[model samples]
Target chain A: MTSTLKIGDVTFSKIPRVLIAKPGLDGHDRGAKYVAKALRDAGMEVIYTGIRQTPEDIAAAAVQEDVDIVGLSLLSGAHNELFPRVVQALKSRGGADIPVFGGGIIPDADFADLKRAGICAIFTPGARIDDIVREIHGILES
Target chain B: MLVRRSLDLNSLASQISGDTVLEGVEPWASRVRALSKALSLLENDPWLATRFLQHPALAKLSTNARVVGLTGLPGAGKSTLTNLIVGRLRKLGKSVAVLAVDPSSTDTGGAVLGDRIRMQDHFCDPQVYIRSMGSRGALGGVSRATRGAIRLIGLLGYDYILVETVGIGQSESEIVSIADTTTLVLMPNSGDDIQLMKAGVLQMADVYVVNKCDLSNPQRMLSELRANSEARGRGNEWTPPVLATSAAEQQGLDEFVDALQKHAEYEHDHPEGRAIKRKRVQTEIATNLLFILEREVQKMVAQVPDAEVNAVQAGQLPAMVVANRLFTEAFAMVQQGKIEKNST
Candidate 1:
């Protein structure tokens, strides 16, 4: 499900930074780590916030790191609550413009709800790394 | 699609200035939001970063925060030691901020910034603020943006600011000018004493820590470090003490911290030490100005006629003559306040 989603009109002369975080009590980090590595390989500065970060922690990190995108990998079924909380946290901190996306074991039924909660895109199981990279490029360029 | 709200410089600055927008009852959360916003602005906008340094609020900010620089080779456990120090400082109720500078990919200008991962133990602590900055094609291990970041963190009321360099040898001397105390972390059995001499790491260190002490005999390295310090006769007053630490095992950190404190105290008590710090700041400001001038000069040169550049390239014109002509024109335009208009 690809759509045009630019982070903002803010231009950066340096490499764009992306903060990939696991924002729930999910011990599974293989997907997060893989995406982080792929993003770094794709020439974006990637700061990986290790697993089990609270929404506040993720938002704070996203701001402090000055990330262009905040990517969350939540394998736990708590995306319904965790995802929106991160978006709310970013918004409260005056970072509403920062693009946020997620990937994990999310159910198809919750896609619209998560989208409504401010997640730009959601990658589920078997999402190819190249496709993810292309999607990120598309989003940033849009 | 996410709702698009335009973020203007004024609103961003207001968010960063700790004004009415951040006057929440919860001090910690509010401070975090304000500081994060300020740093985010500084990181993304070079103009804001420069203006922040010149802002009057910066003069009102406390300069008492000890800026400690940690430098080492790639595998020397600098981040582990930094994490340990952060834990120790937080235990004493002191706030700490870390600026971890990682090397940028020369080809792509990207970085993985994995140092923060090693220091993730403090991720949940509000008192600990860690930001990873890429070297961004700077020759020095630390980037130009670091000094501004340090000043901003100082204004954030942190008691200590630790700057971890890119771990490149020789070029790491830049930290000595910026940090009040520069600690060189080394692992035992890493190399011979000659390598240290060649890197001039001994001359740059205020305190040396032989990390990974549990792995090998550190006494030999320690004694050699001391002897080298003595041979250098650092400033004819203070001799850098070589301590040992096993960061993984969490041993010898107390002595290391004590040594750092003693150095900080010595710098505080001695007038010459203070003068030296002042001198370093003066040099830093001068260097930054020179860098700006160089960039401006490059921009002016880019506007030089291609025929003139080709003439110089083809040896039909002397390079120094062309440079002199360009400098004269640029200098006159500057005097007339027409440089920017002419350049464009």
Candidate 2:
């Protein structure tokens, strides 16, 4: 529970407390909930903020909830507009150090832009649950 | 039981000490981040949480915030009502902090806390701070960290602290001692009058709100609750008011708030107000002591030999006797050393 903990086979330098939120008008949350539950299963505390959240709402929640990572999932293809808004909101609100992660139907062409917009990691569809968990742990470790 | 790396409490304390602020700018956003980190410590690390809670800057905070706890059955609109109450309080220029508790998975000890969904309206408001908590196997509709979380929120200078409990059923009414004002939010037509009387949650409320009035008229339910209130034995001479509110239509919200305000006034005037606070401290101490004792017992049990376990399993030694012996030995160890390790 300190800066580092070893539980079972996994040793984390920092146990990740994440916020899995849906940004934009999309209401379907199969991917968000799946990743949320997957992270929960991997020994993480996930704040699932449910569907149709604005970037500001997501940022406010991430700060107030004190999460180290904000995971946004959107299938509406508005990731280009909404995802960076989340990063900008955080920067304006004194949470610039909190990282943002993306999941759900993002085309490969948009990956670099999303990364440039300050998304540390993106887990597309068919990304294995173990791989997603490993990537998250890797991010926290770095 | 776990020795965590200490946080920079001296630095955090210097920031929260409101002594230097007669007329100066406040670091509101940084305070929010500090509160979030403090709560995370409370939830995940016990040793550090005790130290943080005992720091003078935090420990010096008087109970200035009016803590109002809302509890009801699931889907009874506790979250929506909380949002409405936060909006109303902010309109009155009162800073608000909301602690919404959800249940944890019994299988994996994990939780998906989603109370922010209904509370998005206040997320953008700098005056309102909301945090969702996982119950983490604590009974009584709150997390083990709630005692510490509410204290931290108070220290951060919120005027109103709202604690929304997990959807509670009968007998999960620990909110009685956890809040200064307890409101039970029930939906219309939840059950018959007889069933309502049988419910354990019915007896412990300072106010009752029959929410979602747009779907059904609450006149019948109101009359029933009035009759029930009249029949009950009066303790402090304050009859719990039963009011109706519709979040969808925004009806009777002001009236409900008025009732809450009136109740607060009544409690303030009564000497029993301080009496309730004393009882709350006693209850919180007992709950926390039991939690710590459970941890110590687990430590002792881990050291028990397999032959002792085999004896118990083979019926040669009673498990109750072994438990009693373990408790005495472990508790004596705590009496000498364990408390010093964490409290320091």
Best by TM-score: 1
DockQ of each: 0.24, 0.30
Ten residues in sequence with the least summed lDDT for candidate 2 chain A: A3-12
Top candidate (lDDT): 2
Pick the DockQ winner: 2
- Model 1 earns a TM-score of 0.87
Candidate 2, residues B1-344, lDDT tens digits: the string is: 11122346555554555433212323676667667767877788765666566666655676578889999998999999999998998888999999999887776666778777888888789889999888877889988788778888888779989999999988888888888889999888877788678857787788889998889878888888877776653677678888889999888789877877887887778777666667888998998788777776777788999999999999999999989988787678778885564432
Model 1 DockQ reads 0.24
Model 1 lDDT per residue over B1-344, tens place: 11122344343344444443643224455555556545655555665455544544344455568999999888799988999999988888899999999887777766788788777778767788889887877867788778878877787678999999998666558888899999999888766778767756557788989999988888888888888878755564677888889987899998888888888888788876788788888988897788568778887788989999999999999989988988888788889997563131
Clashing pairs in 2: none
Report chain B TM per candidate: 0.88, 0.87
Identify the CAPRI category of the predicted complex in candidate 2.
acceptable
Model 1, first chain, TM-score of 0.90
